[model samples]
Target: MKFKALWITETAEGKFERSIIERSIDDLPAGEVLIRVKYSSLNYKDALSATGNKGITKKFPHTPGIDAAGVVELSRSEHFGTGDEVIVTGYDLGMNTSGGYGQFIRVPASWVVKKPEAFTLKECMTIGTAGFTAATALHKMELLGQNPEQGPIVVTGSTGGVGSLAVAILSTAGYEVIAVSGKQNAWEYLQHLGASRMENREWVNDQSGKALLKPQWSGAIDTVGGNTLVTLLKGCKLEGAVACTGLVGSPKLEGTVYPFILNGVSLIGVGSAEMPMSTKLKIWDKLSGQWNCREKMNAIAKEVSLEELKNTYIDTILKGNVMGRIVVNVEA
Candidate 1:
């Protein structure tokens, strides 16, 4: 069957081109389930893939969207059947696989989760992979005994997708949240998402060359890696856990072990894409129930069509200009 999709290709000059075009359902990779996608979400990784970032996607002529929510049209696994509403995020969906940029996606049944009772397909995409990563960080931190009562939690990159959701989720879970952002103009938006206050990036990006600094927060959800990750560890309180979620700043970690040995600080790595299905379900359940931040979701979401993704957002995101999650209406 013919379907609409955003397609990316690399030219002989090594430049990548993006366009919306028609695709065939038969062109999809072999999988146990076929979903008619109603919605997908834009992520930084998707922007990288769309721009021919070889690290994110190895092939050209690809569809780039890592998070998808829709209804199952076919299924081979006993876990799902036709007409089942489902969500698929992470696990190679947008990398080497034809992904959610298309109106349809066929993926392994194992990669699919039945849509939570509280979320419509659009709402699911609103939370998307960004929120999933944030939730995973919270899950791991709490597993290590970190709690809101420990003290205020800091969310770095507070205006971006994961950071924005992290602030909301942490606050919804009863933590006092301090949002860190370089954008001085986002204070009101941050406050609306439950952040108690805001800090400039310099507040967390210490450059004093000290091995450690005074503890500013009880714990943290850091999306900006490299020196920012180091700063978080150096300044974290005893038993404080830092969930390292992204490397947008840089992939390098140049720091000492003093935080782990002398301060009892723990660094939790959140790799949501490859997390076990049981854990994925657990996080999704929390997001839909106890951790549901419906108001925050509404405030943080901006819907766009496939053409807009190609004409605008894909480039805008790479430039770090987007404020919140951009949910895509694939059928629009």
Candidate 2:
């Protein structure tokens, strides 16, 4: 059956064009399950794919949504059956394969997870891939023995999806959170999301030539790379860890190994793109339970239709002006 979708194509001149178009499940790439998507979400990676970034999407006329939550319309795998609520994130769903911008999606069973009972289809999109990444980062930190007693945890890119969720989960779990963001107006919003305090983006920038600075945060969840990651490493407490993700600032890092050798600060690279289903399910369980941030997730997310998604969020997020997550209702 034909369904509504947001289609992106490349012009002969090699530019990208986007619009709402009609699609069909039969046209989607072959997989083990067919999902009638209820909700999708706009993410930085989606914006990149929509804008014709080959790194995120190589082919033209693609559907770009990294996060999808819906019900299984058809399932060939014994692990999943028809009429089940499910979610698909990362694992090439929206990268090289057809993704969630369409009303229906067909993906590998390995790319699917049973929607946590605590979250509805909409709330799952609310947490989406961004929240999942944050949870993975925190989980790694906790596994490494990083705790509140060491010192406060700093969340860079604090107003964006991953950073915001990091603040919420960390604070909810009794950790002191220092939200560092450039959006001054979001200070109050960050506080409501459980940030114990707030700092301007300046905290992530350091120009001093010192090999290491005074230890401040016990650990850090860094969403911006480049100098920000370097700064976080330089100021991390002894034996503390930094969960590094996102390169909105830049991909380059030019810092000495002083923090690693002397302070024992370990750099933990967190990437959801290629995570295993076993680890993904474990994190989703926590997100549906104690690590879940319903209030913050709902408050921080803006709901938009597939049409509104293209008309708005793509540019806002690409320019780094996004305040929080953008939820897209594919059914709308």
TM-scores for all candidates? Answer: 0.99, 0.98
Misplaced by over 4 Å in model 1 are none
RMSD of 1: 0.8
Candidate 2 lDDT by residue in tens digits, 108-168: 8988899889989998988888998999999888889988888899999999989888998
Lowest lDDT sum, 10 consecutive residues, model 2, at: 272-281
Q: Which stretches of candidate 2 lie over 4 Å from their true place?
A: none
RMSD of each: 0.8, 0.9
The TM-score of candidate 2 is 0.98
- Collision pairs in model 2: none
The candidate 1 region of ten consecutive residues with least summed lDDT is: 315-324
